[model samples]
Target: MIPALRQDRGQAFPIYVVMVAGLLFLAFAFFAVGQASATRNGAQGAADSAALAAAQRAREELGLRFPGVLTAPGGLDDIFKDEGFVAAARDEAVSFGAKNHADLLPGGWQPHPGRTGQFEFTVTVQTQYTVGRSVIPGTEQDHAKASATAVIELRCGLPPGSGGDNAPAPPPVTITCDGQDVPVDPLPKLEKIFTVKLVD
Candidate 1:
């Protein structure tokens, strides 16, 4: 009887060891998954912020370049065609992506082509982060990518012949800067003529 019990004890010990090993493996897997998720979220956030920064800078540029037009009684059809305006916006997007520890993909900063009235910019960014310190073989480092779009809309309400000195006083013009609708009071001083936002 004693001999039989010793053999059973040896078998049970191996089973216990196997169970502990399996549990440890599962724990490591869960940890890796959680870490990857966090990294992805971070990458997404960076993309959003970068896109927004780019759009905001572009909005500012528009305000500065078309200060008189924005406040005057006119439409924004011609201003969108300015090449310098688009270039400035793209440069800002790249700079913002770099600041967020992400790199903008080549030709990733794209302005919507068909849509002329509203300004829309899209940016794609990539970021790499470590999921584990060489513990998960090929998963030691992972790459995360995200894309975001921002829009700038102009809103103005001017009375007919409002530009003339004899014309009645013009109502305050409002520009949709992202989500905020800011009023542009007085002339030659455009305020919030454009807005920035993340579309995706």
Candidate 2:
């Protein structure tokens, strides 16, 4: 009876060892998954930064040009439908992406408008770093990629007689932005009138 009991105990010891080894591997795999998730979140953050930065730069440019557009015939239409700045703003996006440790992909502009003077920029990026070695296959060489769209919307209400599209906005017009009046004379307060942000 003593010999039989000892033999049973020896068999159970190997079973316990196997169970512990499997649990350790599973824990390691979970850790690897956590690492990959963190990397993906970082990539998304970079994409958002790149796209928002580009939109803000374009807003600044628009601010500098707004009052002048009020005088030029068809300028408001051009301003509202402008796709020129998106291409010009690519350098800005690239700089921003680099700051966030990512690189911008080509063809960042989405030309369709939400309304007059609304533009969307679609930015795609790839992380500069890999997910690192993990139990997951190919993650050691994998780079997480993400895309974000930033929208540029005109916040101030266009004054009456602006004729919607293709008509020049007259000078001495006061536009309402966030319930405050901004005069077009002596430079329009465009920062309040133009808002740039990231869309989901």
Q: How many residue pairs clash in each candidate?
A: 4, 0
Give Cα-based local distance difference scores for all models: 0.67, 0.76
**Residues 11-78, candidate 2, lDDT per residue (tens digit)?**
99999999999999999899999989988998899989888888888787777677766656664556
lDDT of 1 by residue, 56-96 (tens): 77777777756454434343445566656777878787788
Show pairs that collide, candidate 2.
none
Off by over 4 Å in 1: 1-3, 70-74, 113-116, 128-136, 161-192
* Index of the highest-lDDT prediction: 2
lDDT of 1: 0.67
* Prediction 1 TM-score vs. true: 0.76
